[model samples]
Target chain A: MSHPGADRVRDVARLAGRSARSKRRSFLAEGPQAVREALRRHRSGTPTVEQVFATDEALARHPELAEPTDGVTLRRVTADVLAAMSDTVTPQGVVAVCRMLDVGLDDVLAGSPRLIAVLCQVRDPGNAGTVLRAADSAGADAVILTHGSVDLYNPKAVRSTVGSLFHLPVVLGVPFADLAVRLREAGVAVLAADGHGDADLDALQDASAARRLAGSAPDDEGTGPRLEAPTAWLFGNEAHGLAEEELTAADARVRVPVYGAAESLNVGTAATVCLYASARAQRR
Target chain B: MSHPGADRVRDVARLAGRSARSKRRSFLAEGPQAVREALRRHRSGTPTVEQVFATDEALARHPELAEPTDGVTLRRVTADVLAAMSDTVTPQGVVAVCRMLDVGLDDVLAGSPRLIAVLCQVRDPGNAGTVLRAADSAGADAVILTHGSVDLYNPKAVRSTVGSLFHLPVVLGVPFADLAVRLREAGVAVLAADGHGDADLDALQDASAARRLAGSAPDDEGTGPRLEAPTAWLFGNEAHGLAEEELTAADARVRVPVYGAAESLNVGTAATVCLYASARAQRR
Candidate 1:
């Protein structure tokens, strides 16, 4: 791995593109954080990392990354070689070739997921990854990217996740038509996060809190959807938001109220609020 | 405005740099959304926008932008000219020269603000703008950037704010030393958003909610800082987080709980959760 222009370097770099990643069923996870997470997943019996390339300096800085893992090959490379194999200008002297980790929607449903985040037509890779990371922080059981959403394996998206991409199950390219029906069948209420929705998120949280304070069951009082129930939150594109069809498919459309003059929340910010609200309610 | 290399075009383009922006006391606001918001702010008597450069297509697409303002000079320019005057590769057909909108800290404190977000040593432009926008969405009264924080007027930051920059009052370059004292004197509790903080944000919210449900005053039972109290939330840098001094200066250090495997939340996401929590509790 001494030569920057080596065939192996070119092969790893090729994973930066979609066609190559699709053909190989693997993607490059650059930097120590991503590679470290990949090796951890591999050690946990997920077969996540096939190979890890790192410079001596990086390994020295993050010594835990040097730990041996079964079936994971670790190679020492020059910084130039690591950079040549990465999409970012600075790959932080390490890169990992990992298997595509998206699970099937059916597999996720079988787990009886308490909280799920479904991205619909979210075109920006960074936004998709940010929402996914937020979902993980909120203790979401899974995240699903519907058809037409940005590729989760895109290097920028993976980088934006800051290692959380490997922390939870992700289902990619799930069709909205089937997703809505299947989630409902799994007893998970599909709630569309819309700017102009009838149900206000704060109000719903208050209702849930009041119920908890009164020691009442979820179905004791309110006709509105309960925040404590098993639910799937659908977030839309950064620009136009959820389409009419998608909005209509949900059990109820929920809005994160804008108390200021801001016309709307960025999809990532809105999703964080929505997911954290659910996490708090369900945990209580 | 037809020539891309004209002196006027160069003058507008110079705003992309900090020296030129500071010299002129103005910054570039690219894209239609920013320009539209600048015009609105100008029309509302703030004199936010000095001049707007737009292509024929942009003016035609957003007719309201073509409306005459008292001091705003709307000049129709060629697409090439607009691009030459913008920081972005694609200026989206319009750009505006907006006055620096940051107000003095004393003026902001004079208003007895409720919820505020203070950025300490946050270096990334996008993160700064995203947090400001989140603060606005959460109905925060003002946002303060400490001495080491990123420039709020950076073009990417302004664009990232999506016009929310004009929606709220922002205090820039305020040193944490004086900021803490002034805010406390103004009757606002200063809460630092720390990952390892002793106070949990969710628990604070729960306490506030319980007090409300029991028809009690904010200071009735809990010794903790209530989310309903007028407070300033301190968010640290994207990388190393708050300095030890900033953390210790706060009346209470609050942590946004991470329920899952995510080591921590992105600063922007954490800020949103904290600000919105305060907004919800205060409103109730």
Candidate 2:
């Protein structure tokens, strides 16, 4: 489509937000990283892309973007069409419609599945994205988004992931009860990171050490049977942390202690700290 | 001052980026939190706020924002004026021109000055703001933004801070040479955090154990002069870490060990881990 008409453009713009995204059951992916990930997945015969739209200038800007791929058709559209489809400034000049990467619990738990981050009602797109990026970088098995979490495909959330979205399994819209039962059945230790956590993360480190001691021969620092069993570190919303029940359900409560007068750390920063703490301890 | 004309709006928008921010010696502070911080400081005899501009709707929406203050004056302008002035969606309906907080070395070291974060050339506004939030929460005495870092007052940077900008002194634009000399004079230990850091952060943690042990002897951390000291943790640009000279100038090099595919953590996340590690070690 060279250019959608005014009404169609309105529809495309609406697609950039939640309502249209839900209606279409697809979201727009823009930017070099996002588009490149989409194209690569399509070429690898994963999900066939619904549409590939690029401006002539985009094609010129990125000659490689014009490559041929089966089942993935490409078209040159007007800048207006590109603008209609974008929510970020400096659109990567290419856009694509992607069916959500909605993996099921079985698929998520099929692997060794050591580490996972379960985000609860994280409303900010930036925070949710950062958590996913942390999960991806930490080699977590997957990121499960429960009720009230921001939509992962929100353009801002996608931008914040910095392309890690493609590298990891991010399943959204899962409810708390379903996650609790699902992860429990898969032998995952669900831990919650809260300010009032029962134990500081230091204790978690100590617990990992104690587990190692119990599992291995006395001579080693004890590196056998990692204490975490397909772990899920649940982080709550920025303003209010995880609900009391969620905290109680955790195998343990972990906290990143603060020393300053500042009331609290940002949710994204805290989530990164907690994820890194667990990941580091597992390494030890 | 409703609708200061397209020319002025263009000028303000241009200044939101770096070159103009420097040339004009002013930066943008958008959203309720940042604007509220500016307003609070203005009321507290801080003399930093230069002007307050709000739309009629904003004034109506937030009447408490009109509390009379000595140093700052508030201006009620048309919706067009606030819309023209805002960089965020929905505007939070207020904008302020505040003098940058000019924190001198004397002011930074005025108190106990136990910990500090020195960021060099980190260009992302989100990263910079997150670091500020981390530093504030960790009870660090101050944050030093070396040359090439993002303008701390950029609207996005301010938003990321989530109001921590008001809690601590942030010194920006300081040359590296001056920072090194000043820190050395204050008997501070400068630690550089880089990908190639010589010692793992655990070593830094261990270094504090003796302080804590000796601290039990009374006279506050055993006259080792407040475990962390005038200690400054140096961080580098996102794309490029600390320069060879900057890293070498540090008293020690430390790294946060990672167990996953992430070659390195995000700069803000790394800085938070480092600062929090320092915070953990200094506690009683």
lDDT of 1 at A78: 91
- TM-score of candidate 1 on Cα atoms, chains taken together: 0.98
| Angstrom error at residue A148, model 1 | 0.5
Write the residue-wise lDDT of candidate 1 on A1-284 in tens digits.
Answer: 44445888899999999999999999989888888888888888888999888999998999998898888888989987888889999999889999999999989999999999999999998899899999999999999999999999999999999999999999999888878899999999999999999999999999898898888877767687899999999999999999998998999999999999898999999999999999999997
Could you tell me the fnat of model 1? 0.90
Clashes of each: 0, 0
**Judged by DockQ, which candidate is best?**
1
After superposition, the stretches of candidate 1 with alpha carbons farther than 4 Å from their true spots are: A1-5, B1-5
lDDT of 1 by residue, B1-284 (tens): 45444889899989989999999999999898888888888888898988888999998899998898998888888988888888999888989888998899989999989999999999999999889999999999999999988888889889889999999999999977878888999999999999999999988988888988889976768597888889999999988988999998999999999988998889999999999999999996
> What tens digits encode model 2's per-residue C-alpha lDDT throughout B108-190?
86665778999898889888888888998888989999877887877788777877887788887888876876887776778
Alpha carbon lDDT at A265, candidate 2:
69
Evaluated on chain B only, candidate 2 has a TM-score of 0.84
* Cα misplacement distance, residue B21 of candidate 1 (Å): 0.9
